[model samples]
Target: KGKAFFVDLTLCTACRGCQVACKQWKDLPAEETRNVGSHQNPQDLSAKTIRLVRFNEVKEDGKLKWLFFPEQCRHCIEPPCKYIGNMYADGAVKQDPVTGAVIMTDKTKGITRLESWEMCPYNVPRRDEESGIWNKCDMCINRISKGMLPACVKSCPTGTMNFGDRDEMLALANARLAEVQKTNPDAYLADPEHVRVIYLCESAPENYHDRLVASAAQRKNLVAAAPKPKTVTRR
Candidate 1:
């Protein structure tokens, strides 16, 4: 009964409506930015911006292609950030049992290391330098609990952002992937089995973003670096 998101990158026009909607719904303050020759503003996600639309310009077949990636937390079935953060302070990060949404809580302020962020393959979490708290997309849990769609999904003009029950989203993602593969042979769903936020990429996941999908080697390293839980002793 968990919830999920299906992001069809092929359909994304990079209007940034989802990005704005996230900020509005979260009541997050805007970051001051400057023109950096690229359309991608704010440079990267931060405590003020949990979600970001990453613009990447790459050359493919001697032709320039602009890839728009609306990046956010993948809300993994087993979140590494939650595990890593809990190693320092229990409940620093929590996953919603019903929706499987990964959320960073106030307890994160107590964490001393950057292990939580390091453990995340997607590079989603952003830390507040002043408060030492981490932040990221929370799947709009409050709005969804009220029988409403996530702000980003609700405001998306393109068919890029989608949300619903995990099974339903998986079906939708696969169906779209099949349709897209006819045109773009490289089209595939990014980490669909392990992540709740499934992305239908038109090309290789790396063509859109470096950390768009964790590679096999990256996964192996993450597993090797994971800290084992400390055993409790009965007094």
Candidate 2:
């Protein structure tokens, strides 16, 4: 019953089909973006943008390598953001026991502005300007539960975005890593064991984001500092 998603950065062509698909299915509006020098558009994820294709160019072994990471919520088994948000508003955020999908309910409107929205490690949650309701990727739970792939996965023509059971995804990630290592020995899986969404990167995860693969100590701190269930229970 364990749910998971795999992102093979090595196979990603940076086509951004997944990004556009997310917006299309979620009905999210586009943001006005400027020429940011990079082909990456919209600059960053906002309340309206849940998924983004991150591009990074780095020098490796006297050659320039372009890395692409289609980033979104990791849907941690023990979600810190859910703990933090529920402290201010009960039932505002819930994690699906079966799929481990972290969902923000409309009740998120009751959460304090600062407490609920700013505590996520990946900055996944976004608040509606008027309603103050928080939102983020739900792992496309409705589709997943119905035996269908997520829209992003469906639209990915490059075979980069994959979804399956946790064990199957891990096996696919390892097999792909072996193939990628034939040319790039530094390739590895980022936080494979800890997160539901696993990413395979050819270079160090830092080349994508500082928090891409958090250190054990940092993860421990996050878990320890997470709000307690009792603190969030309401009358």
Candidate 3:
């Protein structure tokens, strides 16, 4: 039974503590970023920035609502990145049987970037050009293996990010969703069954962030665009 994460958007403050903790724990360096006229700094995920707290200001029912989404990899139950990666490099991308963490290995250098990324629905994967390896949140496997919560989860000041067993988290997500629905009618759990990271959104999913969940149309387009493997014949 792999572990899972339940993130409560209703409780998130967008303090970016989880974001900063991810960098600190991973020893990832900061990128030079300019103020982009929004609280969402750095603006996007990259080789260095694995987790980002997205801020969206939207008007709902004549009232402006501040939506904060602490975004990271969903770590799909049957990870497409790993499925496709195995074709090119067996160990390039893999899902942990014990923790449900999706890890990108150095051998990812052997897989084509476009193929690997196209397979992902949430578009979470980022590549390091010089190193030629895809990277994303490994669910803080280093700490979790030692029986600790993920760095981001530990760093959250508010009771937003949560980690635990898949069943327990799913139950918690549903229960929280029900409670949130009592107040905000738009609450829903984003892809709870298919992903290890479950996000309980208190508003419309679109208002929280684009790419919040994978869609069938996008998946089809990606499958259509994938490059055909080149075959070599032994003489």
List CA RMSD, all candidates. 3.9, 3.5, 3.3
Name the top TM-score candidate: 1
Better of 1 and 2 by TM-score: 1
Tens-place lDDT digits, model 3, residues 153-203: 999989999999999999999999999899877788888767899999877
Q: Tens digits of per-residue lDDT for model 2 on 1-235? A: 5889999887899898989989988899888989968887877776688888888888987999897888888887777777677776888889888887888889888665354324576666778787788778889888899999999999999888999999899999999999999988888898787788899987887788766776556666765676564565454
- Residue 168, candidate 2: Cα error in Å is 0.8
Error of 3 at 57 (Å): 1.0
- Candidate 2 versus the native: TM-score? 0.89
Q: Judged by lDDT, which candidate is best?
A: 1
Q: Is candidate 2 or candidate 3 better by lDDT?
A: 3
lDDT, residue 170, model 3: 92
lDDT of 2 at 99: 82
lDDT of 1 by residue, 12-41 (tens): 999999999999999999999999899999
User: How close is every model to the real structure, measured as TM-score?
Assistant: 0.92, 0.89, 0.92
Q: Which stretches of candidate 3 lie over 4 Å from their true place?
A: 113-117, 215-225, 231-235
Error of 1 at 223 (Å): 4.8
